[model samples]
Target: MTEILLIIPPFCYGDLSEAGPVYPSMGIVCVAATLEHAGYKVKIIDMFAEGYEESKLKSCLEDPELKIVGVSSVSATFKISLNILKYAKEKRPDTTTIIGGPHITILPDETMKETYIDYGVLGEGDNTAVELADLIIKNKGSPENIKGLCFRKDRTLIKTEKRQFIENLDELPFPAYHLLPMDKYRSYGVYDSGRKTTSMITSRGCPFKCIYCCSSELFGGRWRPMSAEKTIEFIKKLYDEYGIRHIYFQDDEFTVSHERAMKICDWIIDKKIGLTWECLTRVSHVDNELLSKMAKAGCKSILYGIETGYEEGLKQIKKGITLEQAKNAVRLTKKNGMIAKVSFILGFPWESKEEINKTIDFAIKLDADYSFFTILCPFPTTEVYEQIAKEGLFVPEFNMEMYSAMPAADSLIRTKYLTSEEIVQMMGHAYKRLYFRPKYLLKRMLSLRHFSELKRNFKAGLSVLRFTVKSMGKKAKLAKTT
Candidate 1:
C-alpha cells in the first residue's frame, strides 16, 4: 500500500513509436527519495517508461492507503498529467492531488485553476514535497505555512513564500533509482555505448540568459552542484549495483565549475570506474585542458547549444557566446578524440529567410560530428515566449499541443519574413544540408570504432531520413495549397 504515489504521465512529442527513447524522470525520483527518507510509503508510476494504461493507473489509485497523488509534467505532457490527476480524484474522491514541474512552477495561477489539482509545488520540490507529506500524514498544521506550495482558499489562489533553493546539494539523498525501471532505459539516449546506460544530474540551475530557456525560473538562477566526492559516490553506487556503464549527465551545464568538473573526472579516472559519459554544455564553458581531461576520463561526447550562427542572432537571444567560441569549442572537442555534437535553433521571430539559412550554413561549416537542427519552440515563461506575446509574433494557429522542437512538426510561431510552413521548410533544408553531404557520411563511416557506434548511427540516420521525408511531404502539400 502506498501512502503517496508519484507519477510521470505518458507522452511523446511527435508520435508514439517503439523507436522513441524512454527514460525515468529524475525530478520525480528525487522527490520520491525525500518522501521516503521522511518515512512515507511511496511508489513511482513512470507511465512514460511503461506505456500508459488507464486500468493500471486506476488500480494504483484504488489503494486504500494511498492518500496523495503527485504528478510531474513538462509543457508537452501537462494536459495528460492533469487528466491523470483528474482521473485519480474521480476514482478516489478522498485522495489529494498535487501537480509540480517547470510548467506548473511557471504558471501556477493558471494551473491551480484546475479544480482536480489540490496543490502545486513550485521550484526545487524536494523539501516542499516532504513537508506536504508530513503535514498530510500528521493532520495538524495549516498548509498556509508551507513554503513553495500553492493552493486555493475561499476561491482565491494562495501561493506561499517561495522556497529557497537547496544550498548544500550533498545533504540530499540519492534519487530512488531502485524504484525505477532501469533496465528498460538501458542503452537509450543518442550518445549511448551499447552498455547499460542511465542519466544523472549532479547539479542544478544555469547562469546563462538564453531567451528560449527557463532554467533560471526552474532552478532559482543559482548554480548549485554536489561536491565531487558526492558525485563519485553516487556514480560508484550506480556502477556497482546497477552495472551502469554509460551515464548521460543531464545538468543544464555540467562544466559550470571547471574545477569541480575536472575533479569529478579525475576521481572517475583514478578510481578506474571505466564508465563512459557525455554531457551538454555551452560553448563558452570549456577549454582545451578541460576537454583533454574529459576525454582522458572516458568522456565520449560533448553537445554544445550553438543555437544560431548569425552574430546578431546571438545577441538577440542573449546566448552569451560568439561564433568563434563555438568553432573553437567544437574543434577542441574533436581534437581531444570526442564526438562534437552541436545544436542550432531556427524560426526566431526576427529572422529573415536569408538569416535562417545563414545559420544552417554556419552549422555545416562548423564540421561537428553531429548537428541537431530544430525549429525553435517558445515554451511558456521563457523570455522568447514573452517577447512573442509582447510583439504580436505568435501565429494565430499556435497550439500548445504542437509546441515542440522537432523539425517535422509545424512551428508554433512565425518570423517576420517566414510563415510556419516556411520555418519547417528551412528546418528540412538545414537537416539535408548538414547531414547528407558525402564528406559527412564518409567521415562518420571512417570513425566507427565499435559495433555500438554502427547501430546507433544507423538508427540516427533512419530517423533523420524519416523526418526529411515528412518535411518534404509537408512542403509539397503547402505548395499545392498556395
Candidate 2:
C-alpha cells in the first residue's frame, strides 16, 4: 500500500464543498473508501477546516511518497482547483494530478486540455478513481478502457466511455468521516438546531430537468438511491461514532420516491436513535401525509426550491411545479410542525422588475421560517447559460469567476430589463423585505421556546444585519468583481 492525498479546494465565503464548510465532501469520501478498500493509504485534506495553511497544500503535492493526488471543486471553484493543479505539477512532476467534481464532469475535454491536469474523472468518482489508481498509478498499466475518465494521450485528449451508475449504493462504505475534521464542522455552525451536525446523500442523481440546475449536468437524471436499510445504518453510525444529532439529507430530491421516503421515516422511528434530521426536496414531491410522517420521524425542517412566483417563469425554467404546489408544500410543512425554509433567485434572463417583485411578494405571503435570495449565476452546462451565450449577453470579464450565487454587485449575464447594479439591489431588497416583515419577526420570536433559543435568534439576526449592510455596500463598488 502506498500513499495518496485527496484535496477539497476552498472557494467563496471560504466554502470548499456544496454542503458548505460544515460538511465533508461525500464524493471525496466515497473515492477515499474505494482506495482504502484496495489496501491503499489515503488522507483527505478538506481546506475548510480551521488550521489549514497554504504552505501545507504545496507540501502535500510536493511529497514524493504520495503516488496520486485527487482534487475536487464545483463550478465556482474550478479556477482554484486549476491553480492548485498547476502548483502540484510544478512541485512534483511525477505525481498524478486528477481533477474531479462538477466542473470537469460537464466540460471534461476542455478541462483535460489544461497541461497541468493529468486526468479528469467524470460524474461519480468512486469506481473511476479506483480503476485509475489500480491501472495507471499503482500497476503502471495502460489507461485506456478506464471508463468515466478523461486525459491527454500523446498530446491528444481522450475520454473513455461513461461508466454505469452505481446500482447497489448499499455496497459502498459509509463516508470516511474519520479522515475528516468532525469537531471543526460542529464549531462552524453548520447544523440547524442540533448539538452535532453532519450530512448524508442517500441518492446519486436528480430526476428533474430544471434548466438552471447543475444536478442533471453532473450526475445525469438517473436517481439511484441507497435502500432504506442503508439510510438507517448510515445515520446510526454517524450518531454513535461522531455524536451527529442532526443529519442534513442533501439528496437532490429526497422524496422523489414517496414510498421509499415513508419507509425511511418508518425505519427511523423503529430505531429510535434520537437523531433529528433535515432534508431538501422539490415542492411537488411531498404532501400532507408525507410531511406528517416526516415530522413523526424527527424531521425538524424542510427546504423547497420555490424558484419563481409565476407559472410562466416556471415554464421557462422547467421547474415542473406550479406555484400552488409550492405554496401547499410550505403550508403543510409548517402545519406539521416542521420548519419550512424556501429559496428564490433573482436576475433571470426573462424576468423584469415587476416579475421579480411578484416573486418576492409571493415568498413573504408564504411566510416560511427562512428564505434565501441570490442573484442568478448562469453557470456552465445549463439552459440559462446556453441562452445567455447564444444571445451574447454574458459579460466577457466575469465569465466563470462570477458563477457564485451570492448577492454581488456584478452579474455575469445581462438580463433584459435589469442592470448588474439593480439586480444586486433587488437581492438585498428581497432579504430586507422577507426578514423584516412584522409577521416574520413575530412568528420567529414566538417560535423560540427557550432563553438560549432567543439568544441564538438574536445572534442570527445580527449576522443577517451585517450581511445586509455588506451586500448593500458591495452594490456601490467593484462593478465587475464577485
Candidate 1: Cα lDDT at 482: 12
The digit string of per-residue lDDT tens for model 2 on 1-482 reads 23788888765542112223366677898889888887778888887554446697776666667878788978666777787778877888888889998878877766776888888898889988888888765685567778888888899988888887788899998778888877666322322444677678999898888888888767767799999878888888888888888777888889989898999899888888776888899999998899999999989888899888788889989999999999899999989988888988888998777888888888888888888776787767888988988877776676444543433434676688766666766666677778977878897787776665666667667766655665566544423211
Candidate 2, which segments miss by more than 4 Å at Cα?
A: 14-21, 58-64, 186-194, 404-409, 449-463, 470-482
Task: List the global CA lDDT of all models.
Answer: 0.84, 0.77
Looking at candidate 1, the ten consecutive residues that score lowest on lDDT are 473-482
lDDT of 2: 0.77
Find the candidate with the highest TM-score and give its number: 1
Against the true structure, candidate 1 reaches a TM-score of 0.93
| Per-prediction tally of clashes | 0, 0
The most accurate candidate by lDDT is 1
What number of backbone clashes does candidate 1 have, counting pairs of residues 3 or more apart or in separate chains? 0
Instruction: Measure candidate 2: CA RMSD.
Output: 3.8
lDDT of 1 by residue, 260-294 (tens): 99999998889887789988999999999999999
After aligning candidate 1 to the native by TM-score, how far in Å is the CA of 258 from where it should be? 1.4
